[model samples]
Target: MKKLLIGTAALAMVAGAAFAESHSVVRLGTEGAYPPYNFINDAGEVDGFERVLGDELCARAEMTCEWVTNDWDSIIPNLVSGNYDAIIAAMSITPEREEVVAFTQNYTPPSPSAFVAMGDVDLSGSVIAAQTGTIQAAHVTGMDGATLLEYPTPDETVAAMRAGEADAVLSDKDYLLPVVEGSSGEIMFIGDDVPLGGGIGMAFRKSDPEMRAKFDAAIQSMKDDGTLNEMIAEYLGEDSPAF
Candidate 1:
């Protein structure tokens, strides 16, 4: 859901020609690990909410596209390096990320973040696990008494909590709710939901305003026609907020 380090200037240099070529087939980058938003299916293909939404957006914009999976840690850098034309992962629109890449309007509204643990425990001064390079991780790091534990993937964060490496795991409430429910009382959510970032949006190279504009328009069209909200419900559940 975020990034840590990237060479913004290098990304801009590499994006120049790609952004200028309007008719080229766009390559969409994603971390095929975040379920509901995206994940690798048993068939070894990217599949989930973003996959469906992205395909629709591409069709609406009249752009041919393909999916490319990359680790969350290097997703942004790869986009800048011309490895992909855009990032359709469930990336939150944050100021820190905006400095390195441009973002389209949010498709999903800002969802609440929550903490999950095996039992009731005080969050203050406790060790917490969060996916590395995410807003949740940054938020936990700055908490007055919390010691943040970072993991490369969301699954690892949950594993850390189960193994007692952390007192709790913090992440999007939507993402955690199903896991908590499926755990059959082994894991439960504690603490109030916290809102972070500006919702989820697609990321583009800073030089790719044209491509960004194409997608922004396509996204707005979906919202106007109720297609976007429908897709959100299909993947994130009926209660999921729309644009």
Candidate 2:
């Protein structure tokens, strides 16, 4: 749900012009692995919450846009390199990440982080699995006497727990809730929820304030009209917090 890696390279204005031109394609990068937030459908196309929300935002902003999938680990660097214009992946607005890429105002409210295990397990001194480059991983790293097993994807963290590689898996609760429910009692939550990050927002290269401002206005528009809250309930869950 959160990632931070330093990327240093100025985005050229030629590429910035793409953000300026009417009907020009703005590539929105995402992992396409995290679901409900984002995932590839059976049609092998990027589909899910961000896909719909992004399309609406682009339409409101009067820009043409397309989806681009990249590994979670490299999503930020690629954006800095102009591989994509922005990141609409379910990324949280953490100060660490803000050091590298400027974020549009958050679109989704902060969700809880949670721990799930094969059965009820004590979190103290337990080995926990978390996705690489996520806030959960960073949080687990500081837990006293708890070992953190890092995986490169959300699915891997769950797989690691199922394989007995970790006592539990730590991740965004929204992503883990479906897994826990579908596990048929095989996995259950083990601890109080942990809240991390400011909220979920789109990330853009630091050089593209114009692009950032454009999307921010569109997002603010949604928040004002209650469409953002409607989409949050539809995509995230009815209980998810509103703007």
Candidate 3:
């Protein structure tokens, strides 16, 4: 979802001096619930592609960094409230979000969104599930004759479909691929893959251009030396998109 201005003061801060000070320890906010992108590992630590990428960017930028978990619905607002210095969540760069924050250059190329269902059911006029506040949710909302069931987490979206409460669950193909493969013929991909959002990028409060620039340069460095693509393959599989 696009960042919502929490209040008049929060709106003013976003418009005024949001994150003006240099942070010695830059806090990266993310949705710890999103897998492949991010998740709390069995060890109860933040672990995934973003965790690895965030650490490398912090190292290349020569800054001490820490990870902070937030629910996806409020991730952007927490950054605006100074709860974190930046968002490294697998957030797509979109004009609606750009109005509230600035994005570093994309770290991953645009990825397609897709749907999963039990059989060859048509999606038109069917009830579809999507994580609340996600591009998938917004897309399903606008689909002709489609009914949307929104959940707070990605897992719930899939769960609803499994329980037969939803005809299908829509999300990033990268996130759904493993689930479909593991379903043992119970679930399968359906319908055409839908391109959604721009490429994924890190976000900073608009006032924190310096912090944004630091990571942007670091991301470009990774892209230049091929470390970024290697990491993407390591975590997101060989077929995943590179910079």
Q: Against the true structure, whose TM-score is highest?
A: 1
Q: lDDT by residue for model 3 over 103-213, one digit each (tens)?
A: 999999988888999998778889999988788888888899999998888899999998999999999998998899999999899989898887899999888898899
Ranking by TM-score: 1, 3, 2
Model 1: per-residue Cα lDDT over 94-159, one tens digit each: 887777789999999888888999998889989999998888898898888999999999999999
Worst 10 residues of 3 by lDDT: 1-10
Tell me each candidate's RMSD, in Å, in order: 2.1, 2.8, 2.6
Model 2, residue 96: what's the lDDT? 73
TM-score of each: 0.94, 0.93, 0.93
Evaluate model 1: give its lDDT: 0.85
Candidate 2 local lDDT, residue 114: 90
Candidate 2: tens digits of C-alpha lDDT, residues 73-165: 878777877888999999999887777778999998888889999986778889999988888988998899899998889999999899989
Alpha carbon deviation, residue 213, candidate 2 (Å): 0.6
